[model samples]
Target: LFLGLIILIAVWKLSQTFTIMNLGKETSESLGISYSLLEKLALFLVALTTSVTMITVGALPFLGVIVPNLVRKRYGDNLSQTKLMVALVGANLVLACDILSRVLIRPYELSVSLLLGIIGSLVFILLLWRGGQKDAV
Candidate 1:
């Protein structure tokens, strides 16, 4: 199961890297890569990862939406850079939240997963709201 999880994560990260590099089906196809194949591969990888995460960590609810976007916002769309930044930020966020939860609760640490879900969701909502409300002109 651990090996499966690792494979799924690798595939998921690679798929995301490819997608970031290519941007869209038309662009990817023009560049001679099979977008359909890549899309299917990505979906499969994501599904596997999600299933493992759900079963192992319970409902995550927001890491998927939150961490990657946080990275993209900070680093823009460079694939390698985005992946590196996301991994770093995600790790830092998890570590910080875990510490906060431990210290605040005192011998009753909230699950890191739960903290991430709440924090990520709230942050994502605020970002979306701000983006939507910003003037387009």
Candidate 2:
């Protein structure tokens, strides 16, 4: 519920803010966007999104950082599209990891978080090693 609202804000109210910020601090500020306020709002929205998600669905390690990078890597930095894509991709990635967890141990099933932690860590390391990211995580 709250996550959905924040997602909507990210997709709607804050999309222009993100686009402006993407232009870098000086340019965004010159354009009359209050960087600090928007930054605080973005951070608060992210915190609420994270808290709501963690409280409801439990944690999926590194999905926070990983999904956005993957989306941006493919779609560029359109935060509206990237925000929606991140939600969809995160859901799909979790489902895929859940399936893998159920199958990997045959008669046993691993918790999704554990599999996510392992997989997320490896992918993050790989991304860091690849190292051509124009955006800072």
Best by lDDT: 2
The best candidate by TM-score is: 2
Candidate 1 local lDDT, 1-137, one digit each (tens): 78565864686567555855467777778877777887787777778877877776677657677888767776776665566667677678877877887887887878877787789888988878877887211
lDDT against the true structure, each candidate: 0.72, 0.82
**TM-score per candidate, chains pooled:** 0.79, 0.85
Model 1, stretches more than 4 Å misplaced?
1-17, 20-22, 134-137
Model 2 worst lDDT window (10 residues):
128-137
Residues 1-137, candidate 2: write the lDDT tens digits. Answer: 76666576665777867888888878989999988888888888777777878788898899887888888888988786676788799889999999999999999999999999999999898778676554444
Ten contiguous residues with the weakest lDDT in model 1: 12-21
Colliding residue pairs in candidate 2? none
Deviation from native of the Cα of residue 79 in model 2, angstroms: 1.3
